[model samples]
Target: MTETSTGGKGAPATRRLSAFLYRHDRLRLAGLLTPPILWLVVLYIGSLGVMLVSSLWGVDSFTGSLVKKVSWSNYHTLFTEPVYRTVALRTLGIAISVTLIDLVLALPLAFFISKVVQGRRWRYALLIMVTMPLWASYLVKGYAWRIMFDKGGVIDWMFAPLGLHGPGLGLTATVVALAYLWLPYMVLPIYAGLERLPESLLEASADLGASPLRTLRSVVFPLLVPSVVAGSIFTFSLTLGDYIMVKIVGGTTQMFANIVYDNVGVAGNLPFAAAAAVFPIVVILGYLLAVRRSGALENL
Candidate 1:
């Protein structure tokens, strides 16, 4: 009798708590979101805050120890140094090249898969092929490109008949490899946007006596701009932060990412590395702001 009474009492309390939560929608939402909010605050924002704080500190030149004092010396060096400026420009150029190359390649392929392909099965197959490279390891893809660009490799063999040579490992190779790697990122968004586009609009354009080129230019291209910008965000930001690809196929080329890596690993200067790492973050934030201003983020 005593055990039964205690069990009955606990059941009512549990039911009451459940009923309270069910009645309070905002409270229930807060309970559900609290864990993820805590994780974002503690892990992501906390780490960035630590890095920013460390960037403000300096390393003692003589002892190679960290100085606890806060100073702007690291940022000062990055702004004032010519080599840093050169690496920043080179990194920006490479990123832009990769984004443009991917954009040009993705547009037609996405159009064909989403619009021209006759059957659902064929479209799915092409999409699978486009995304298959992503399943492979990043290092594997980089090294594969390295082999293709090697002297007397597949590229050279193919071009031998044309009396040409492979690009070898350099900026050209870096741009090509980066483009190939990020092509799927560019293709999928444009493909989705094309899929969502109404065929009635195209039919109306044709009915209005617009040529194929005109329909594509005035109708398809304008509608697709938001998706293009969305995909460019991925490609551009990725290329900006890439270091391993350049190391594999960049020959002697040094990107901004390479500067950050070298500072941390080779130079053992954490403060400076943290500062150098801010360059890409700033650039990406600026890009996001520009995209936001253009209203492309709404599509995303």
Candidate 2:
């Protein structure tokens, strides 16, 4: 039988490429990373830089046009205005509330799903149930919640027997909607972290005569801190930037995002909006810094 040359020139080509990559490590790394680096620099960082610069610039009230001249007036207004302060604080409060609510709800459910649940199929089913909401449209979810919060709606109907009523389109409704929207984000991370936890350690803790609560406090929670922080980063930042849900369910309550939108669209003041937009970014950065300080990010 005649021997056929398998792989033809593929082997030599692959070997040559491997040799070149090995010889030029920096070049290979740059080649691998250049696309993402370019995207970050050109899109994300560039947009942020533009926002910062525009926030510093002023609008010509006489001509009703943007002035290229740099000024601190917009930021000064953001600082000095009472409405701005109130809205900023309110938005911060709502974000914090959403994060806390999601965390409280996610922890136990994640533990149940990751540790207590038996069989792979059941575990996957629970995870799917947890994540299924995310497949729905964002606007659809918001509007659905809006309907539920409306007068004589599902929430009102449910609470009517208790001689109470739903928190009609307001801060509470907004927080509830946000928590519902972001809960999956919080759950998945904690579930993953919990699943990754060593069963042997848990066994050891029980063997060492630690109660369930004590074991969780002294072992599980400490290891889960990084995942919790990671999840909160998403929930907090998403809540901070969200304006649509608030618009739908928040009624007259204006979040920082709502204020920014009003300034940009109603007031026709992009510079002022840009300046106001810096607050959430600053707040999120501060949170990330706090998380880092606690060494959770290092674990991540």
- For candidate 2, the 10 contiguous residues with the lowest summed lDDT are 1-10
Badly placed stretches (over 4 Å) of model 2 are 1-15, 295-300
How many steric overlaps does candidate 1 have? 0
Deviation from native of the Cα of residue 227 in model 1, angstroms: 1.1
* C-alpha lDDT (0 to 100) for residue 222 of candidate 2: 90
Model 1 local distance difference test score: 0.93
What do the candidate models score in CA lDDT, each in turn?
0.93, 0.92
> How do the residues 58-85 of candidate 2 rate in per-residue lDDT, one tens digit apiece?
8888886888889999989989989888
**Per-candidate TM-score against the hidden true structure:** 0.90, 0.93
lDDT of 2: 0.92
Runs in model 1 deviating more than 4 A are 1-20, 295-300
**On residues 158-224, what C-alpha lDDT tens digit does candidate 1 reach at each position?**
8899999988899999999999999999999999999989999999999999999999998998899
Q: Candidate 2 clashing pairs?
A: none
Q: What lDDT score is found at residue 219 in candidate 1?
A: 91
